[model samples]
Target: MNNTNTVPLVAILRGVLPQDVLAHIEVLIAAGFTTVEIPLNSPDWQTSIAMAIARFGDRIQIGAGTVTSANDVAILSQMKCSFILTPNTDPAVIKAAREAGMQTCIGCHTASEAFVAIQHGANALKIFPAGELGSGYIRALKAVLPKHIPLYAVGGITPANLAEYLRAGCVGAGLGGDLYRAGQSPEQTANQARAFKQAWDACQKR
Candidate 1:
Protein backbone atom coordinates (compact mmCIF):
# COMPACT_ATOMS: atom_id res chain seq x y z
CA MET A 1 0.00 0.00 0.00
CA ASN A 2 1.12 3.57 -0.67
CA ASN A 3 2.19 5.51 2.42
CA THR A 4 -0.63 7.56 3.95
CA ASN A 5 1.90 10.07 5.37
CA THR A 6 2.31 11.86 2.03
CA VAL A 7 -1.42 12.50 1.43
CA PRO A 8 -3.48 11.51 4.41
CA LEU A 9 -6.99 12.07 3.05
CA VAL A 10 -8.65 9.11 1.31
CA ALA A 11 -11.34 10.44 -1.05
CA ILE A 12 -14.26 8.02 -1.18
CA LEU A 13 -16.35 8.37 -4.33
CA ARG A 14 -19.58 6.60 -3.62
CA GLY A 15 -22.27 6.33 -6.29
CA VAL A 16 -19.95 7.85 -8.85
CA LEU A 17 -20.76 6.88 -12.45
CA PRO A 18 -18.27 5.24 -14.77
CA GLN A 19 -18.48 8.17 -17.18
CA ASP A 20 -17.55 10.72 -14.53
CA VAL A 21 -15.16 8.70 -12.37
CA LEU A 22 -12.08 9.70 -14.35
CA ALA A 23 -12.93 13.38 -14.23
CA HIS A 24 -13.28 13.28 -10.47
CA ILE A 25 -10.05 11.31 -10.15
CA GLU A 26 -8.21 13.79 -12.37
CA VAL A 27 -9.21 16.71 -10.18
CA LEU A 28 -8.45 14.77 -6.99
CA ILE A 29 -4.98 13.99 -8.28
CA ALA A 30 -4.42 17.64 -9.17
CA ALA A 31 -5.51 18.65 -5.66
CA GLY A 32 -2.85 16.33 -4.14
CA PHE A 33 -4.98 13.32 -3.21
CA THR A 34 -3.01 10.20 -4.05
CA THR A 35 -5.49 7.69 -2.68
CA VAL A 36 -9.17 7.14 -3.51
CA GLU A 37 -11.85 4.41 -3.35
CA ILE A 38 -15.11 3.86 -5.22
CA PRO A 39 -17.46 1.90 -3.03
CA LEU A 40 -18.80 -1.23 -4.77
CA ASN A 41 -22.40 -0.23 -4.36
CA SER A 42 -21.98 2.49 -6.95
CA PRO A 43 -23.42 1.99 -10.43
CA ASP A 44 -21.27 -0.33 -12.52
CA TRP A 45 -18.65 0.07 -9.82
CA GLN A 46 -16.28 -2.46 -11.25
CA THR A 47 -16.19 -0.66 -14.57
CA SER A 48 -15.43 2.61 -12.86
CA ILE A 49 -12.56 1.02 -10.96
CA ALA A 50 -11.20 -0.59 -14.09
CA MET A 51 -11.26 2.73 -15.91
CA ALA A 52 -9.58 4.46 -12.98
CA ILE A 53 -6.76 1.94 -12.74
CA ALA A 54 -6.26 2.02 -16.50
CA ARG A 55 -5.96 5.79 -16.50
CA PHE A 56 -4.53 7.00 -13.18
CA GLY A 57 -3.29 3.82 -11.54
CA ASP A 58 0.28 4.91 -12.33
CA ARG A 59 -0.34 8.32 -10.80
CA ILE A 60 -2.27 7.40 -7.67
CA GLN A 61 -3.66 4.47 -5.67
CA ILE A 62 -7.05 3.17 -6.86
CA GLY A 63 -9.27 0.78 -4.91
CA ALA A 64 -12.80 -0.22 -3.89
CA GLY A 65 -14.72 0.06 -0.58
CA THR A 66 -17.67 -1.53 1.23
CA VAL A 67 -16.27 -4.90 0.33
CA THR A 68 -17.82 -7.74 2.36
CA SER A 69 -17.37 -11.01 0.52
CA ALA A 70 -14.29 -12.97 -0.40
CA ASN A 71 -16.17 -13.77 -3.60
CA ASP A 72 -15.46 -10.26 -4.85
CA VAL A 73 -11.79 -10.51 -3.97
CA ALA A 74 -10.93 -12.59 -7.00
CA ILE A 75 -12.67 -10.16 -9.32
CA LEU A 76 -10.86 -7.15 -7.85
CA SER A 77 -7.56 -8.96 -7.88
CA GLN A 78 -8.06 -9.73 -11.55
CA MET A 79 -8.45 -6.02 -12.17
CA LYS A 80 -5.22 -5.41 -10.30
CA CYS A 81 -6.89 -3.02 -7.90
CA SER A 82 -4.38 -1.78 -5.35
CA PHE A 83 -6.47 -2.20 -2.20
CA ILE A 84 -9.80 -3.12 -0.64
CA LEU A 85 -11.66 -1.22 2.13
CA THR A 86 -14.30 -3.17 4.02
CA PRO A 87 -16.87 -1.54 6.27
CA ASN A 88 -16.52 -4.39 8.77
CA THR A 89 -13.82 -6.79 9.71
CA ASP A 90 -14.16 -10.33 8.30
CA PRO A 91 -11.14 -12.52 8.82
CA ALA A 92 -11.90 -14.62 5.78
CA VAL A 93 -12.15 -11.58 3.55
CA ILE A 94 -8.97 -10.11 5.01
CA LYS A 95 -7.01 -13.28 4.43
CA ALA A 96 -8.37 -13.68 0.92
CA ALA A 97 -7.39 -10.16 -0.06
CA ARG A 98 -3.93 -10.47 1.48
CA GLU A 99 -3.37 -13.75 -0.31
CA ALA A 100 -4.36 -12.08 -3.54
CA GLY A 101 -1.64 -9.45 -2.94
CA MET A 102 -4.09 -6.61 -2.44
CA GLN A 103 -3.81 -4.27 0.53
CA THR A 104 -6.65 -4.62 3.07
CA CYS A 105 -8.06 -1.76 5.18
CA ILE A 106 -10.52 -3.43 7.50
CA GLY A 107 -13.05 -1.49 9.54
CA CYS A 108 -13.45 -2.16 13.24
CA HIS A 109 -14.98 -0.24 16.12
CA THR A 110 -13.71 -1.91 19.31
CA ALA A 111 -10.43 -3.30 20.54
CA SER A 112 -11.48 -6.90 20.01
CA GLU A 113 -12.41 -6.29 16.39
CA ALA A 114 -9.23 -4.28 15.79
CA PHE A 115 -6.99 -7.05 17.14
CA VAL A 116 -8.86 -9.61 15.07
CA ALA A 117 -8.26 -7.58 11.93
CA ILE A 118 -4.56 -7.19 12.72
CA GLN A 119 -4.16 -10.90 13.21
CA HIS A 120 -5.78 -11.45 9.80
CA GLY A 121 -3.14 -9.28 8.06
CA ALA A 122 -5.04 -6.05 7.59
CA ASN A 123 -2.80 -3.37 6.13
CA ALA A 124 -4.69 -0.66 8.03
CA LEU A 125 -7.67 -0.11 10.30
CA LYS A 126 -10.70 2.08 9.57
CA ILE A 127 -12.91 3.30 12.40
CA PHE A 128 -16.36 3.51 10.88
CA PRO A 129 -18.89 6.08 12.09
CA ALA A 130 -15.95 7.98 13.46
CA GLY A 131 -17.92 11.15 13.94
CA GLU A 132 -20.13 9.40 16.45
CA LEU A 133 -17.23 7.52 18.03
CA GLY A 134 -15.37 10.84 18.36
CA SER A 135 -11.66 11.48 18.30
CA GLY A 136 -11.56 10.33 21.92
CA TYR A 137 -12.31 6.82 20.69
CA ILE A 138 -9.33 6.93 18.37
CA ARG A 139 -7.12 8.36 21.09
CA ALA A 140 -7.97 5.52 23.43
CA LEU A 141 -7.76 2.92 20.71
CA LYS A 142 -4.37 4.15 19.55
CA ALA A 143 -2.88 3.67 22.96
CA VAL A 144 -3.08 -0.11 22.64
CA LEU A 145 -2.74 -0.71 18.92
CA PRO A 146 0.62 -1.56 17.42
CA LYS A 147 2.57 1.64 16.86
CA HIS A 148 3.10 0.70 13.24
CA ILE A 149 -0.56 0.17 12.46
CA PRO A 150 -2.35 2.96 10.60
CA LEU A 151 -5.79 4.07 11.80
CA TYR A 152 -8.21 5.78 9.42
CA ALA A 153 -11.40 7.46 10.60
CA VAL A 154 -14.22 7.09 8.09
CA GLY A 155 -17.81 8.41 8.06
CA GLY A 156 -19.14 11.90 8.74
CA ILE A 157 -15.70 13.48 8.20
CA THR A 158 -15.33 16.92 6.70
CA PRO A 159 -12.46 19.32 6.07
CA ALA A 160 -13.41 21.22 9.22
CA ASN A 161 -13.33 18.17 11.51
CA LEU A 162 -10.60 16.33 9.61
CA ALA A 163 -7.73 17.65 11.65
CA GLU A 164 -9.35 16.75 14.95
CA TYR A 165 -9.19 13.05 14.12
CA LEU A 166 -5.60 13.33 12.88
CA ARG A 167 -4.62 14.98 16.14
CA ALA A 168 -6.32 12.10 17.94
CA GLY A 169 -3.77 9.77 16.28
CA CYS A 170 -5.44 8.80 12.99
CA VAL A 171 -2.91 8.35 10.23
CA GLY A 172 -5.61 9.80 7.98
CA ALA A 173 -9.36 9.77 7.24
CA GLY A 174 -11.70 8.41 4.56
CA LEU A 175 -13.68 11.22 2.90
CA GLY A 176 -17.12 10.26 1.64
CA GLY A 177 -20.09 12.63 1.09
CA ASP A 178 -17.96 15.63 2.03
CA LEU A 179 -15.71 14.91 -0.89
CA TYR A 180 -18.11 13.66 -3.57
CA ARG A 181 -21.81 13.09 -4.09
CA ALA A 182 -23.40 11.43 -7.07
CA GLY A 183 -23.97 13.91 -9.95
CA GLN A 184 -21.62 16.51 -8.43
CA SER A 185 -19.62 18.25 -11.13
CA PRO A 186 -15.90 17.75 -11.59
CA GLU A 187 -15.27 21.40 -10.74
CA GLN A 188 -17.13 20.95 -7.50
CA THR A 189 -15.09 17.85 -6.75
CA ALA A 190 -11.92 19.85 -7.37
CA ASN A 191 -12.97 22.52 -4.89
CA GLN A 192 -13.89 19.95 -2.23
CA ALA A 193 -10.60 18.12 -2.74
CA ARG A 194 -8.64 21.35 -2.40
CA ALA A 195 -10.45 22.20 0.82
CA PHE A 196 -9.60 18.84 2.37
CA LYS A 197 -6.01 18.98 1.14
CA GLN A 198 -5.66 22.42 2.68
CA ALA A 199 -7.08 21.11 5.92
CA TRP A 200 -4.53 18.29 6.01
CA ASP A 201 -1.71 20.71 5.20
CA ALA A 202 -2.79 23.04 7.99
CA CYS A 203 -2.93 20.13 10.42
CA GLN A 204 0.63 19.09 9.58
CA LYS A 205 1.83 22.59 10.47
CA ARG A 206 0.47 22.37 14.01
Candidate 2:
Protein backbone atom coordinates (compact mmCIF):
# COMPACT_ATOMS: atom_id res chain seq x y z
CA MET A 1 0.00 0.00 0.00
CA ASN A 2 3.07 2.26 -0.21
CA ASN A 3 4.03 4.55 -3.09
CA THR A 4 6.92 2.29 -4.06
CA ASN A 5 4.62 0.61 -6.60
CA THR A 6 5.57 -2.65 -4.91
CA VAL A 7 2.69 -5.06 -4.91
CA PRO A 8 0.90 -5.74 -1.65
CA LEU A 9 1.44 -9.13 -0.05
CA VAL A 10 -0.93 -9.44 2.90
CA ALA A 11 -0.44 -12.13 5.55
CA ILE A 12 -3.93 -12.86 6.78
CA LEU A 13 -3.68 -13.60 10.50
CA ARG A 14 -7.06 -15.06 11.29
CA GLY A 15 -6.47 -17.28 14.34
CA VAL A 16 -3.32 -15.86 15.90
CA LEU A 17 -3.50 -14.91 19.57
CA PRO A 18 -2.58 -11.65 21.21
CA GLN A 19 0.54 -13.17 22.76
CA ASP A 20 1.65 -15.01 19.63
CA VAL A 21 0.91 -12.33 16.99
CA LEU A 22 4.30 -10.71 17.43
CA ALA A 23 6.07 -14.02 16.95
CA HIS A 24 4.30 -14.50 13.62
CA ILE A 25 5.08 -10.91 12.76
CA GLU A 26 8.72 -11.84 12.93
CA VAL A 27 8.04 -14.87 10.79
CA LEU A 28 6.23 -12.73 8.24
CA ILE A 29 9.18 -10.36 7.96
CA ALA A 30 11.56 -13.26 7.76
CA ALA A 31 9.40 -14.80 5.06
CA GLY A 32 9.67 -11.61 2.96
CA PHE A 33 6.24 -10.24 3.82
CA THR A 34 5.60 -6.85 5.41
CA THR A 35 1.83 -6.43 5.30
CA VAL A 36 -0.43 -7.98 7.92
CA GLU A 37 -4.22 -8.15 8.35
CA ILE A 38 -6.19 -9.25 11.41
CA PRO A 39 -9.83 -10.02 10.78
CA LEU A 40 -12.37 -8.69 13.29
CA ASN A 41 -14.06 -12.07 13.23
CA SER A 42 -11.10 -13.49 15.11
CA PRO A 43 -11.36 -13.58 18.90
CA ASP A 44 -9.57 -10.75 20.69
CA TRP A 45 -8.49 -9.35 17.36
CA GLN A 46 -8.40 -5.79 18.62
CA THR A 47 -5.83 -6.77 21.22
CA SER A 48 -3.83 -8.60 18.60
CA ILE A 49 -3.89 -5.60 16.25
CA ALA A 50 -2.95 -3.19 19.01
CA MET A 51 -0.10 -5.37 20.16
CA ALA A 52 1.12 -5.88 16.64
CA ILE A 53 1.12 -2.13 16.04
CA ALA A 54 3.02 -1.50 19.26
CA ARG A 55 5.78 -3.76 18.03
CA PHE A 56 5.91 -3.60 14.22
CA GLY A 57 4.32 -0.30 13.35
CA ASP A 58 7.57 1.05 11.99
CA ARG A 59 8.39 -1.71 9.55
CA ILE A 60 5.12 -3.42 8.73
CA GLN A 61 1.80 -2.19 7.40
CA ILE A 62 -0.88 -3.29 9.86
CA GLY A 63 -4.50 -3.57 8.76
CA ALA A 64 -7.88 -4.80 9.91
CA GLY A 65 -9.78 -7.17 7.63
CA THR A 66 -13.48 -8.06 7.37
CA VAL A 67 -14.29 -4.46 8.14
CA THR A 68 -18.01 -3.82 7.50
CA SER A 69 -19.08 -0.55 9.03
CA ALA A 70 -17.70 2.96 9.46
CA ASN A 71 -17.40 2.17 13.15
CA ASP A 72 -14.96 -0.67 12.51
CA VAL A 73 -12.79 1.65 10.45
CA ALA A 74 -12.90 4.25 13.22
CA ILE A 75 -11.95 1.63 15.83
CA LEU A 76 -9.04 0.37 13.77
CA SER A 77 -7.94 3.92 13.09
CA GLN A 78 -7.79 4.41 16.83
CA MET A 79 -5.60 1.33 17.04
CA LYS A 80 -3.23 3.10 14.62
CA CYS A 81 -3.89 0.71 11.82
CA SER A 82 -2.35 1.94 8.54
CA PHE A 83 -4.74 0.09 6.28
CA ILE A 84 -8.32 -1.17 6.10
CA LEU A 85 -9.53 -4.24 4.23
CA THR A 86 -13.05 -5.54 3.75
CA PRO A 87 -14.43 -8.88 2.58
CA ASN A 88 -16.96 -6.90 0.55
CA THR A 89 -17.14 -3.41 -0.86
CA ASP A 90 -19.12 -0.98 1.32
CA PRO A 91 -19.24 2.64 0.20
CA ALA A 92 -19.85 4.01 3.71
CA VAL A 93 -16.81 2.33 5.23
CA ILE A 94 -14.78 3.12 2.16
CA LYS A 95 -15.67 6.80 2.41
CA ALA A 96 -14.81 6.82 6.10
CA ALA A 97 -11.43 5.19 5.54
CA ARG A 98 -10.68 7.48 2.61
CA GLU A 99 -11.47 10.48 4.76
CA ALA A 100 -9.41 9.07 7.63
CA GLY A 101 -6.38 8.81 5.29
CA MET A 102 -6.00 5.04 5.48
CA GLN A 103 -5.13 2.73 2.60
CA THR A 104 -7.87 0.29 1.67
CA CYS A 105 -8.15 -3.05 -0.07
CA ILE A 106 -11.76 -3.71 -0.97
CA GLY A 107 -12.90 -7.18 -1.86
CA CYS A 108 -14.92 -7.87 -4.99
CA HIS A 109 -16.25 -10.88 -6.89
CA THR A 110 -17.63 -9.42 -10.11
CA ALA A 111 -16.79 -6.60 -12.53
CA SER A 112 -19.53 -4.37 -11.17
CA GLU A 113 -18.32 -4.79 -7.59
CA ALA A 114 -14.73 -4.23 -8.62
CA PHE A 115 -15.65 -1.05 -10.44
CA VAL A 116 -17.67 0.18 -7.52
CA ALA A 117 -14.72 -0.36 -5.21
CA ILE A 118 -12.50 1.60 -7.55
CA GLN A 119 -15.06 4.39 -7.72
CA HIS A 120 -15.07 4.45 -3.93
CA GLY A 121 -11.31 5.18 -4.00
CA ALA A 122 -9.99 1.83 -2.92
CA ASN A 123 -6.19 1.59 -2.95
CA ALA A 124 -6.29 -1.94 -4.26
CA LEU A 125 -8.77 -4.60 -5.33
CA LYS A 126 -8.87 -8.05 -3.77
CA ILE A 127 -10.33 -10.74 -5.97
CA PHE A 128 -12.02 -12.94 -3.45
CA PRO A 129 -12.49 -16.62 -4.22
CA ALA A 130 -9.78 -16.20 -6.82
CA GLY A 131 -9.40 -19.95 -6.99
CA GLU A 132 -12.93 -20.33 -8.21
CA LEU A 133 -12.31 -17.67 -10.81
CA GLY A 134 -8.93 -19.15 -11.72
CA SER A 135 -5.74 -17.18 -12.40
CA GLY A 136 -6.63 -16.70 -16.06
CA TYR A 137 -9.77 -14.87 -15.11
CA ILE A 138 -7.70 -11.85 -14.13
CA ARG A 139 -6.81 -11.15 -17.74
CA ALA A 140 -10.45 -11.10 -18.64
CA LEU A 141 -11.16 -8.54 -15.96
CA LYS A 142 -8.05 -6.58 -16.81
CA ALA A 143 -9.37 -6.17 -20.29
CA VAL A 144 -12.27 -4.19 -18.92
CA LEU A 145 -10.67 -2.46 -15.93
CA PRO A 146 -8.02 0.11 -15.45
CA LYS A 147 -4.51 -1.09 -16.16
CA HIS A 148 -2.92 0.70 -13.19
CA ILE A 149 -5.23 -0.86 -10.63
CA PRO A 150 -3.45 -3.56 -8.65
CA LEU A 151 -5.18 -6.89 -8.21
CA TYR A 152 -4.65 -9.19 -5.24
CA ALA A 153 -5.69 -12.79 -5.27
CA VAL A 154 -7.26 -13.93 -1.99
CA GLY A 155 -9.14 -17.04 -0.87
CA GLY A 156 -7.68 -20.40 -1.89
CA ILE A 157 -4.21 -18.97 -2.34
CA THR A 158 -1.68 -21.31 -0.76
CA PRO A 159 1.96 -22.40 -0.85
CA ALA A 160 0.96 -25.17 -3.21
CA ASN A 161 -0.65 -22.96 -5.84
CA LEU A 162 0.96 -19.57 -5.26
CA ALA A 163 3.30 -19.70 -8.19
CA GLU A 164 0.49 -20.54 -10.56
CA TYR A 165 -1.46 -17.51 -9.47
CA LEU A 166 1.49 -15.13 -9.47
CA ARG A 167 2.57 -16.27 -12.89
CA ALA A 168 -0.93 -15.64 -14.09
CA GLY A 169 -0.52 -11.89 -13.31
CA CYS A 170 -1.72 -11.44 -9.76
CA VAL A 171 0.17 -8.60 -8.13
CA GLY A 172 0.02 -10.32 -4.69
CA ALA A 173 -2.00 -12.70 -2.53
CA GLY A 174 -3.74 -13.08 0.82
CA LEU A 175 -3.38 -16.35 2.70
CA GLY A 176 -6.16 -17.21 5.14
CA GLY A 177 -6.44 -20.73 6.62
CA ASP A 178 -3.35 -21.64 4.61
CA LEU A 179 -1.08 -19.32 6.55
CA TYR A 180 -2.35 -19.27 10.12
CA ARG A 181 -4.04 -22.39 11.36
CA ALA A 182 -6.20 -22.19 14.46
CA GLY A 183 -4.48 -22.96 17.77
CA GLN A 184 -1.09 -23.19 16.11
CA SER A 185 2.01 -22.70 18.17
CA PRO A 186 4.62 -20.09 17.38
CA GLU A 187 6.91 -22.73 15.95
CA GLN A 188 4.19 -23.99 13.63
CA THR A 189 3.38 -20.47 12.51
CA ALA A 190 7.00 -19.85 11.65
CA ASN A 191 7.14 -23.07 9.68
CA GLN A 192 4.09 -22.17 7.65
CA ALA A 193 5.46 -18.70 7.06
CA ARG A 194 8.69 -20.12 5.75
CA ALA A 195 6.86 -22.46 3.42
CA PHE A 196 4.72 -19.67 1.97
CA LYS A 197 7.68 -17.36 1.56
CA GLN A 198 9.61 -20.07 -0.17
CA ALA A 199 6.75 -20.51 -2.59
CA TRP A 200 6.61 -16.79 -3.31
CA ASP A 201 10.38 -16.70 -3.72
CA ALA A 202 10.14 -19.45 -6.27
CA CYS A 203 7.77 -17.27 -8.25
CA GLN A 204 10.31 -14.47 -8.26
CA LYS A 205 12.87 -16.71 -9.92
CA ARG A 206 10.63 -17.04 -12.93
Q: CA lDDT of each candidate? A: 0.92, 0.85
lDDT per residue (tens digit) for residues 97-179 in model 2: 99888999899999999999999899888898998899888768867888778888999888898887777777788888888
lDDT of 2 at 55: 91
lDDT tens readout by residue for model 1, 90-146: 999998998999998899999999999999899999999999999999999999999
Q: Looking at model 1, which ten-residue stretch has the lowest summed lDDT?
A: 1-10
Model 1 TM: 0.97
Off by over 4 Å in 1: 4-6
Question: Which is the leading candidate under TM-score?
Answer: 1
- Highest lDDT scorer: 1
